[model samples]
Target: MDITPVANPALDPVQFPRLEEVEYLPVSTKYRGMRLALWGGVQLLVLAICLTPYLIYKFGGEESMATMSAWYWPVGIQAVFSLLWFLEEWKGFPRRGYAVRERDITYRTGWLFRSTTTVPFGMIQHSELSQGPVSRKLGLNHLKLFTAGGSGNLRIAGLEDDEAQALRAIIEARTRR
Candidate 1:
């Protein structure tokens, strides 16, 4: 048997499909509330921890004016940082979205430094659905797709319960084929 090497043909870039042109569906609006509840709880917990030391010092009958003044700076800095972080999440939520095509699924995220990940259905080994306490309370679910080989997995969060289940079913059907 003789194996002949075929001539390589150059492909035109213009013929390729444009990912930016694909219509992406935004995540559920309830995601904002879930994020606020989750982050707000976290911030409050951290603030409480930070204030514990100061509260102990003051209530322990050894209150120093210097210590009280010192506490303000650290707590103030933390408060400001948390506020900025929350704002980032709020502003960036709209930019987070996903698109499911007949052959693949794409997820785009980030506000400042954007990222887009696409996973073909043929490459998917399995998928899972998950929800955190806040997400469950908000009726939101996260769909995680695990691809074959060492390729990275993809997670599409902030989806409504029904939407996530439908998407999971679609993925399951596609993978079965």
Candidate 2:
């Protein structure tokens, strides 16, 4: 049996559709609120933990004022960090979006270091929908797609429950074919 090498041809890049040109749909508006709430809750929890030592020192009737003063540093640092984190989430909310094409699903995120991920239906092994307690209360769901080799798994968060269901169904149908 003789195997003949086929001629390799150069394709024009201009003919292909640009990802930037795709009209991505913004995630649910409630997503921003949900994220903010979640972040606030986490920050509060950490702040409470950090303050425990100081609270113990104060309540235990310790005489060392310096020890209690040192605890303020952690709390102050956390306040600054939390402020920046909240600001990033608020400002970057607009940048999170997704686009579903006939062949693939794309999710774009990030404000400073932007990232876009595309997963073709052919490569998707399965898709799942998940919701955290806060997201569930906010009527939001996260769609996660697992690829064949486990390398291209993608999670698109902040989708409305209905939208996530529809996308999952579409992916299920396409993968069946």
Candidate 3:
């Protein structure tokens, strides 16, 4: 998994350095599909809500249903957004993984459309270890690295606590020096 800059003169020396070998961190694959299921359930609930007014109009009351059906466009848009989110997550989260290289880190994600993003240690401003409720139950922690950019925070999730700590130290050491 090593990406070397030894033969590529065009690559920046500070960014690529002379990588030895890149190491992939351990990640949970068991719950990879859960996200999609959860999102789908939420979307279905919304769909039911959206159709409730129409159902009422057809049976319970005409004016009442028409008043509620005013939300048709908004609810329809929400359903479409939910569907897109589900599709994106279903195709992305399962394929997500990270690799630590000598001078930078790379994350590969997405299902139908894959993306590989590399973040050099030099650009990392700081980092943190975080765990959500589910992650805490699984004893998993994520390493979140912040860069100079306002929205470029990199998160490497589903790592062991010790691994997260070690990665934090490595990133700090590399960035501070």
Best by lDDT: 2
| Candidate 2 clashes between residue pairs 3 or more apart in a chain or in different chains | none
Tens-digit lDDT track for model 1 on 1-177?
Answer: 999999999999999899999999999989877778778999999899889889999999989999888889878989999978886787888889999998999999877658899999999998999998878888999999998874769999999999999999999998896
Q: Is candidate 2 or candidate 3 better by lDDT?
A: 2
Tell me the tens digit of each residue's lDDT in model 3 across 1-177. Answer: 999776744766678443224554536664454455556787889888887877777667566645766868878798779877777776677567777777788877776677767888888888889887867776778788888884667887777777778778878888887
Deviation from native of the Cα of residue 4 in model 1, angstroms: 2.9
RMSD of each: 2.4, 2.5, 8.0
User: lDDT for every model?
Assistant: 0.89, 0.90, 0.73
Error of 2 at 143 (Å): 1.3
Give the backbone clash total of model 1: 0
Off by over 4 Å in 1: 1-3, 12-15, 59-61
Per-residue alpha-carbon lDDT of model 2 for 1-177, expressed as tens digits?
A: 999999999999999999999999999999888778778999999999999999999999884879988999999999999988877787777989999899999999877557899999999998889988888988999999999999899999988988889989988998996
